[model samples]
Target: MLKSDKLERLELYKDRNTQVFLNKFLSEEISELEPVYDPKVGYHYPIVEAIVGSVQDAEAFLNRLYNAGILERRLYDKIIYCPKCGSANVSVRYCCAYCKSFDIQRSALIEHVKCGYMDVEENYKKGNKLVCPKCHEELKKPDVDYRRAGTWCTCKDCKKSFDIPVVAHFCRDCHTAFTFEDAVIKDVYAYTLREDAKEEAARGWVIIAPIRDFLLENGFEVESPAFLKGKSGANHMFDIVAYEGK
Candidate 1:
């Protein structure tokens, strides 16, 4: 059971929108609330948005429940956003490592295993036949004569060869260009009801009120829902804690 304050906090779920959100889990419609990725919004819980009005409102409500220990949250993904405007609508841009030019060509590096000669595939093309540029050997079979060594890139503007390119991001919303170091990163999480809270969700708080009244009538000071600290210094919640004189 939740503490008295936490139980009071549960009253927020009584709102129609919140009930609709919880009912989905209560009815076993969804076991976990996973976020859907949106290019415009980054990561959002669609079901929560549909029930709770907006994405921001849905996230706030889920966060509140998590804080109250009613829901458990797990990191689902991480998204990068534009730092300038804080928008997730960003596009990735790969540029040449030398001149930062967008005009670059990608080709596979082929190696003649027989002679240990390696070069780009384009240099080995000899009128529909692969001929090793270094050894001038006509390739016959894969692994026998030549094999794909690796992928290589060349900048057309600078005519420089490189194995890796410079990565940057462009914000569609603010039209701002930035690198990974300048982008804002946020963690997205998925939520599920706490194991103990599932049963309480299925049965409303009304059932617990009568039990609390019965204890009070029997000449006892009762905390309907209480937090008790254990010997280990851990606080555990109880449905009822009653004291009859000391």
Candidate 2:
């Protein structure tokens, strides 16, 4: 379709409302939609999840409602993604920068007040005696002689030192490795009905109930749940149909 033609055809109700998500949302007392995540199910976002329980093409149904402007999405949650394929099935782990090993331990760094020097606490160990690395002085009192500066992570494999270990994401599904820069951060969203859509849904069959009754009182035959064939040789069903002089 042409861009201008598509833009002009973007009219409301051009497509029929399936009311799949809307019916489920309206049925709920609390319409506040949120994303619920489980390790087994990955991610479940309200109405879409509810409708997809019995159907296979849940994404298609959601896309339809979204395209019709009946469903509005709100930022809900976030997940880590694989840089290669943009898959969310990824695992995060801290590794050593030098050897890229997972075997790493963290320890506090001690600072000598006398010499104004800071090093790892393990460096000050001298045969069960705390010694200052800088001045090489025997530390008697901990508070007076030295204090803890910060913590440092050391790689057991390569014996390399670092303030913070390198964080890398591993794609479990595709078996891919990506650095923090390469790792993609994606936002998940919760779906809700638009205000106009909610009003339309709220009206529902109640709107047609009065019209059907009026037609019945004025001597007209009403056929509800009527099935008819369309010009395209497709079966069309109507919730209500009225016939005059029948």
Candidate 3:
């Protein structure tokens, strides 16, 4: 742990003027900690911990890094194993749980398409599935062979253009089946903030948009941070400037 070094550094910052030093240290260290963001934090805990200072500081730093565009975060599919079998073997049936059959499917052209019934004219393409309703089946998807068919299907389940073959994963849990892409994933560029990650401390946690809105809502003239020559001659921008008020 870098506790000793940090505490020693803290000692140097004991004087009232230490705030400036702290700012410098934070900015400098962030750049050095550049390896923590990718492929999950499971790999480099030491480096992340040292750069982050403390757990709380690490979290705050991560958030600031996100805003600065040094790193990005996005949602992904909630992949889990079937509790009953503990086997990775799985498929969305009807729109529910991973079933062992293929009596249901969803066509992804318009929107929802799981129900076997309903004849809607769809100029759909191949490889689309929707969640099933009745048995709570997860929509079935097409394989390479199915995509080659170039068939368009309008599903009555979701009223979307998705093509299905048979029963997909049926949710034995909630009985609600559907197709989805895990959310957006955060993408961070190493070079984006590498040089100045440490310098970002002055910007603080609050994002510019919200802070700007706060100023507007409360009726204050606000503008960009005044640029000043930092300790190392780095030109810097403050997070904000607002009129003093109640």
> Which predicted model would earn the best lDDT?
1
lDDT at residue 143 of model 1 (Cα atoms): 80
Best by TM-score: 1
Task: Say which prediction, candidate 1 or candidate 3, comes out ahead on TM-score.
Answer: 1
Tens-digit lDDT track of model 2 for 1-246: 233222222232222334444666677744755666655334655445565652235556665666666678877777777777756678887899888886888889898889898888889999999998778998888789988877899999999989888888888877898888887786666777777666654554446556777889999898654557899999776656788945
- For candidate 3, which ten residues in a row score worst on lDDT? 182-191
Residue-level lDDT tens digits of model 3 in 168-195: 3433444433333321223332222333
**Model 2, stretches more than 4 Å misplaced?**
1-20, 54-56, 81-89, 110-115, 121-151, 171-186, 204-246
Q: Global lDDT for candidate 3?
A: 0.40
Model 2 gets an lDDT of 0.69
Tens digits of per-residue lDDT for model 1 on 159-204?
9999988998889999998988998989899999878777665444
Residue 66 alpha-carbon offset, candidate 3, angstroms:
3.4
Using lDDT, rank the candidates from best to worst. 1, 2, 3
Candidate 2 matches the true fold with a TM-score of 0.56
**Candidate 1: how large is its RMSD?**
5.6
Q: Which of 2 and 3 is ahead in lDDT?
A: 2
Clashing pairs for predicted structure model 1, backbone only: none
Residue runs of model 1 more than 4 Å from their true location after superposition: 1-17, 203-246
